[model samples]
Target: MLILGAGQVRQALDGAESEVVEAVRQAYRLHERGLTELPHSVFLRFPDSARNRIIGLPAYLGDDTPVAGIKWISSFPGNVAAGLERASAALILNSMRTGQPEALLEASVISARRTAASAALAAATLAPAGPQTGVSLIGCGVINFEVLVFLSALLPELDTVTVFDLDRSRAESFAARCTARLPGLKVTVADRVEDALAAHRLIALATTASTPHLAVESCRPGTLLLHLSLRDLTPETILAGVNIVDDADHVCREATSLHLTEQQVGNRDFITASLGEILADDGYRRDETALTIFSPFGLGILDLAVADLVRRTADHLGLGTRIPDFLPG
Candidate 1:
């Protein structure tokens, strides 16, 4: 078995958001064509703690090059206060020839990059107004940081960013980092979430909120909301937009904003199209009139595709530790 640590993973994917976005785009196209098998993610939560849980996502992606894997990840929101990462993950890819474990990798970076790439792809493919100069980030976390990076990679017109976080200090730190990463980029730390929401035509919500507590009525028409957190927007807010999801069946569960809206309306009529359908059918050339919301379910296939790329890159770069006898010989 080959073992890749976080540093190795990062080294393999450095400055590769464009490639990662294309990988995510291809994964969505393949998924739309039914070239993947993705079962429901397994959530293991404790009875005492509602904010923390571990998830197991098993997926098989088939094309000319086929691969299978499972990502084991844990989300503990309380870790941030202690100066620790909120999420940690690992992925194990199985050999297609012998069905044996071939590689093990630290997957939090893969997860974040793939997720951001997916969001970037959606933003590029769905935004009818094209890339905006200014954007708003609702949460100042690692996920949003990566999202901003990928968005900038895909849409270079984005030069201004407004950010809001309950922890003002963290928002300030996030701003500094953003400016440092993309020189000449202007970043604002907003004191109120509403101000951040109204700051730009492009908005990304990436928080750990377990419930819906947001209203989007104040935003302008044709606003692009990348609801990455999945639970920040209210059902009514969701209904106000032309909702596009990665997969209706996968997203319309887990009590997400879409799920809550479905329960409230007793149907999925608000959903306009899957990101896959939009990608496969080329989702552009439409008049910009109504609100647009892209709510991805964070599909397992995305993780698999990105992780496989990392694995291949690491292999080519001579990274990772090879355990010749990790399995029974």
Candidate 2:
């Protein structure tokens, strides 16, 4: 077995945005082609902590080089209040040929990177061609931070960003961090969610809002909304848009913004198409008169794909610890 720590995983993935996005794109294609199996993510919630839960995602990506894995990830929003990261994760990858556990690796980084890659990939696919000079990020969290990191590669022409968080200080700090990481980008802290939502045509929503808050009128027409957090928009707002999701069944299960839209409408007629379908074909057209919401339910295959990449890269770079005959003889 090979063991990869968080630091090692980070090192292996550093500056590999293009590769990671390609891997995520392949995973999406595999899933769309019915070459992947994804069980609904299992959630473990604590009665005492309504806002926190741990999720287990099990998936198999079938292709010429098949892979299977499970990601165990925990999210504790209060951790940010305590000056700690709000999420942590671990992944166990198994060899498809022998059914033996091949590697155990830190997964929070993998999770974040894949997520950012997916969002960036979707943006690159759906967004209109022009100057990507401005973007609005509605949540100043780790997820959006990573989104900006990938966007730096995916949309290098972005010159302005406006960010907002419930906690203004956090938003300000996020801006400072972005200014440092992405030079020549003007990062501003928005005082209101509506202000942030309206700051740019390309909007990213990654807040931890437990329930619906955003309304349909918050954004202008033709807005490309990356609904990363999944629970930030109201049912009416979700139904009012041209929705694109990673997976319809998965996104509609967790009471995400899109799920809420489904619950209210009693159908998924509003969904435009899966992101994979759009990525697979260049002839797909976007309705520029409507708000385009891309709400990804965070697929397990994405984690498996990114984790496999990290494992192979680490192996080539001699970056992880190898444990010989640890499972059984």
Candidate 3:
């Protein structure tokens, strides 16, 4: 068995944004081609605390090298107040040949990076016309920080970023980090969500909002909303936008914004196209005058893809801890 820590995973992926983006793109294409098996994510919630829960995403991706894995992740919104991370995760990978677990990896980094890469990939494809004037980040957290890192790599022409959060201090800190980490990019803190939403044409919603807080009227025309935090927007807001998703079936579950939209609209016709479809076929239509929303349900296959990449990198560099004869005969 191979055991990888967060630091090792980070080292393997350092300065590898382009490769990671391509990896996520390939994962999407494989999934679209029916080469992936993904079951609905399992959510385990607490009866007393609505703000904390855990999720399990199990999936299999078939290619020249097939792989199966499950990501066990926990999210506790109150962690921020306690000076801890909001999310933590681990990935367990099983060998296809023996059906035995071969590796265990720290997955929070993988989770955030893959998410950012997907958003970056979609940003490049959906808004290929020109560089975005700026981007509005709705949440000031680790996820948004990593998103900014990848966005800078993907869209360096972006010179400004507007940020907002319920906690003003967090927003300020996030702004400072962005400015320091990404030279030549200006980061500003917004006092209100509406102000942040109006500040840029490209917006990323990464908050832990359990219910809908945003309305369709708040967004501007020709906006690209990266709804990363699934359940933050109202059904009306979702119905009014030109929806794009990683997988329609995956996003339309677990009470996400798209799921609520489907429930309200009684059909999936509102969804414009899957990201894979847009990537595979250039003829996919995108209305520049409408609000384009990309809601990714955070596919398990993504975690697997990055995990495999990290494993190979670790092997080449002699990084992860190895345990020979991990399985008994």
Candidate 4:
């Protein structure tokens, strides 16, 4: 077995945002071709801590590059108070031919980057044409930072970013980091959530809130809202938007944004389209006059895609720890 560490993964992913986005697009296409199986993620809850939960997502990606992987990610919202990230993850990739464990890799950066890449890809695919003038980032954290990096690539016209966070220092720090990473982009720390929402027509939500909520009354009509934090938008907000999800069955079931919307509205038909269907040339039309929301439940195919890339790159560069053969020949 080969073990790829975080540093190697980060090195392999550097300046590869466009490639990752393309991989996500191809994964969606594979889904359309009926070559993938992504079941709803399974959650393991902690008995004592309300904020602690671990998720297990398994996926199989078929076609020429056959592969399978599982992402084990844990979320502890309280970790931020202790100067730690709210989420951490690892992925295990297996050989498709023999179903043997091939590699184990750190997934924190991989997960964040692939997710942001997918969001950027979706925005490029569905958002209105023209310069991407402004964007609002709801959560000023690691994920949102990476999201900005990917968005900058997809929307080169992107010049301004409005940021909001409950913690003022965090928001300021995030803005500073953005300015350093994306030299030409302007980062403004908004005083309030509404202020951030009202300033930008393209909004990205990456908060840890499990409930259905966000104050966006001041948001302009036809704003493209990327609900990267799963269940951040209220059902009323979802109903008012041209809703798109990564998967209908997985996201509209029990604990995701679509699921919360279904519980609130008492219907599942509110979803307009799935990413796969949209990529498949299904008649999924966008309502230009309506608000748009894209909620992806964080598909495992993305994890697999990044893992495949890292594995190949690490193999070529000899970057991982190759374990001695445990199974005797």
Candidate 4 error regions (>4 Å): 282-285, 326-329
lDDT of 3 by residue, 209-299 (tens): 9888776566778889999999888888888788899989889987888888888889999888999998999876567789899999999
TM-score attained by model 4: 0.96
Model 2 C-alpha lDDT versus the unseen true structure: 0.91
| 129-245: candidate 4 lDDT, tens digit per residue | 456778999998888999999999999889999999999999999999999999999899999999998898899999988777676688888788899887777777777788888
Q: What is the lDDT of residue 141 in candidate 2?
A: 91
State model 4's lDDT: 0.86
Please report how far candidate 4 places residue 263 from its true position, in Å. Answer: 2.3
In candidate 2, what residue range of length 10 has the lowest lDDT sum?
212-221
RMSD (Å) of each candidate, 1 decimal: 1.1, 1.1, 1.2, 1.6
**Candidate 2 residue-wise lDDT, 53-168, digit = tens:** 99999999989889999999999999999999999999999988888998999999999999999999988888775667788988899899999988879887888999989898
- Regions of candidate 1 where Cα sits further than 4 Å from its true position: 283-287
lDDT measured at residue 94 in model 2 versus the true structure, 0 to 100? 96
lDDT of 3: 0.91
Q: Deviation in angstroms for 153 in model 3?
A: 1.1
Note the Cα lDDT for every prediction shown.
0.90, 0.91, 0.91, 0.86
Poorest stretch of ten by lDDT in candidate 4: 280-289
> Which consecutive 10 residues in model 1 have the weakest lDDT in total?
280-289
